[model samples]
Target: MKKFWLSLLSIIIPASAVTFEDNDTVVLLGNTVIERAQKYGYLETAINLSARKKKLKFRNLGWSGDTVFGHARSYFGPPKEGFDRLKSDLTELKPNVVIVCYGAVAAYDGQKGLTEFLAGYETLLSMIQSSASPREIVIVSPPPAESLGAPMPDMREHNKRLALYSKAVGKLAQKHKLQFADFFTTLGESKGLTDNGLHFTPEGYQTAAPKLVEALGLSVATGNQLQSEHARKLREATVAKNKLFFFRWRPANETYLRLFRKHEQGNNLKELPMFDPLIADAEKQIEALKKTTLSLK
Candidate 1:
């Protein structure tokens, strides 16, 4: 009888492992914005949020400075060992949702032709779909580039061409019945949320994160700060240190530190000049955290 029970338990354990292995995974592929997500802690933030919500596993496969065509070309080159490596990577991961967010580097005229670009993109998507059998695919449009530094002659034309390309991608999404996120429409304005013209600032991600959550059909729990407690504390300390070290604004540092601490403690509403919508969102997030804490008890 004891032997029978042990055998049953062993079978059950492996079956459970198989079940967990079949759980959904989300893959994000893009350029520096997506890569910076992991570097600057936004990916961590997304993971925390997903864990709390019991959503799909999130994976970042962003390659810095890589455009769609560049990545495609790399798959055929000695560097990437070509298409075989890409196939192997995708097969091993077996993601459920694949989010594609490239085109910044491809926006350059010398590197892009609309016909060739579309053909390559289509082939890539078809290959992934057939090989990996992911449940969904999401194509994200690149945001408008800024005009801060000396403007290139092709800058405006590049943006215009990319916009057309985005529209074409959207059409493909419709044809394929895939999910599409028009980030350009959401983040195109000069004053929308970018720090530089191209790369997203923390504030930019803050605005974009919620929209992404909504687009993905994840639960929208308001009031919980997007960042972890440790990150929040570190950010506060860094701000304080910078003020004292670089600017020598001791009095302002004290005030800023006090406000940051107060904000951390969920006791303050006074806005600092540095407090953007992202910080505002963080304050709201604290409220959500408090509620979750109480509920857990």
Candidate 2:
């Protein structure tokens, strides 16, 4: 049964990785799993490497400690408020592709929350599809925390619970006829990939990001592979652009801006829009620096 599932997964996602088209806007959404991806830059770099002849834009709208119901995004409001916020944000970003990661945090409730998790997951999926109508959706199962030496949270049981959620995610992907990336099986229980067992190290993200690339039927290449003085400059420019966009997408001090106490500091929201010009400037630099195409294999 396990072998059958793995084989099925390869056919749907990793094996037939979705080929990105020209001018595609890829959005990464979820909890800390996706939020932390911005820091490493591996995931974005991998996707960019996969670009054949077109430039792609990426937006990271992940919130730390969020659940399937947008818990973290809620910011002291009801989960539905977070969902609405997500909807509003997506309406603004207008991404044609969305990558979703959730489930790990919810698994904290163990087997007891399985049913609720499944129901909530279904609702979340519908909401996402509705928000970004006609967009391609890829679901990523939360990678299990490493339970090896030094990291002691008795994650063995957590892994067991995660396994169930992973299976459910796979089934949901199949049922919806969408792509699914099983991060759990690929990086879960692996050592050296995570620093604190729960969070991934930079190496871990580089390793894991490839799995998604594979699922998208895309090859991997690193900035180092582009051997040229200009390529180096372009890589740095890309990183700069990404950083600027990150601030625009996920600004700090949400407590006073869009969250619970937003009323107190709502006036400060003006600063958030200022990132737009900086991001545009950085993007122009990246475009000017892309003098050569990467040899993505």
Candidate 3:
């Protein structure tokens, strides 16, 4: 429970100088924080809002309680098997920009696993760079846990350890000359934001999203704030579109998709393909909407 709470607090959504290009397929990979990002659509909306081009694609592939070595995806096997799954997905996505977030769970080991953690991180980075041949790679540092004078368990200690891990991430980014964003250094005064000291409240994600946009490229446009009805609808559409994509990426009742359970419900696999068209429709809507929003600004 301690590790889980502390891990949740270690968010790594980042801002960078590398803005999205027209042809870029931006892929976000990480843990629960990344999964939760899709619900509010703040981060994706901000990235799209800051884009200087049209037809950019965004894919979020974050799973809860994942580790640097793909532990969460292990699925009752060794972590290397999960890493292979990650490799396969990235290869298929062929993303141009891959933004990675990890280090919270690794921090749970404290100083003991820091070295191994970094090594796995480097390995993961190298594997993706080699396989995906991505034009841009960005590493994000996890956000620190905040204590608002509450009787929290060893949060101070957890944060202190996470700080060291974040530093290691920055140093690795520098070595590779990749873009880096340190949410640990950013996200000031997180008290009363994240309930349970880890996961993001919708408001918490809303607060962090623009900062993430700023870290990725240009500052978020004032129009992106939804101060106007058009902006509000556009933003709302973006969220709705993201929700559809989520189903496409992570469908429910996955026990039928593959493995032994397919014998009973394999026929449903054909139904899963239907989501592709829905996802495409949402993407098209976003492209059309982005034009109106851009013109309005």
Model 2 regions more than 4 Å off: 1-15, 222-239, 253-268, 287-297
lDDT (Cα, tens digit) per residue for candidate 2, span 43-131: 77666767756767778888889887775676566668877888888878878888888888888887888789878889887887777
Question: What is candidate 3's TM-score against the reference?
Answer: 0.87
* lDDT (tens digit, per residue) of candidate 3 on 1-297: 456445644654344587567768989899888878877777777778677455788888888899888877756467787898788888988999998989877887989898999899989999899879999998888767756455755477778787788878988888888988876666644565577677788888877877666655566767544345655666677778777767766666666676558888878778766877887788888777766766755
TM-score against native, each model: 0.60, 0.83, 0.87
In model 3, residue pairs whose N, Cα or C atoms come closer than 3 Å (at least 3 residues apart or on different chains), thus clashing, are 11-142, 11-143, 15-215, 15-216, 16-215, 16-216
lDDT at position 9, candidate 2: 46
Candidate 1 residues 177-280, lDDT tens each? 67766655444444445555677787767666655554444443344444446445433432333232222211244333444454453333333334444433
Model 1 lDDT-worst window of ten: 11-20
C-alpha lDDT of all candidate models, in order: 0.53, 0.73, 0.76
> Which residues of candidate 3, in runs, are more than 4 Å off?
1-16, 223-226
**Which model is ahead, 1 or 2, in terms of TM-score?**
2
lDDT ranking, best first: 3, 2, 1
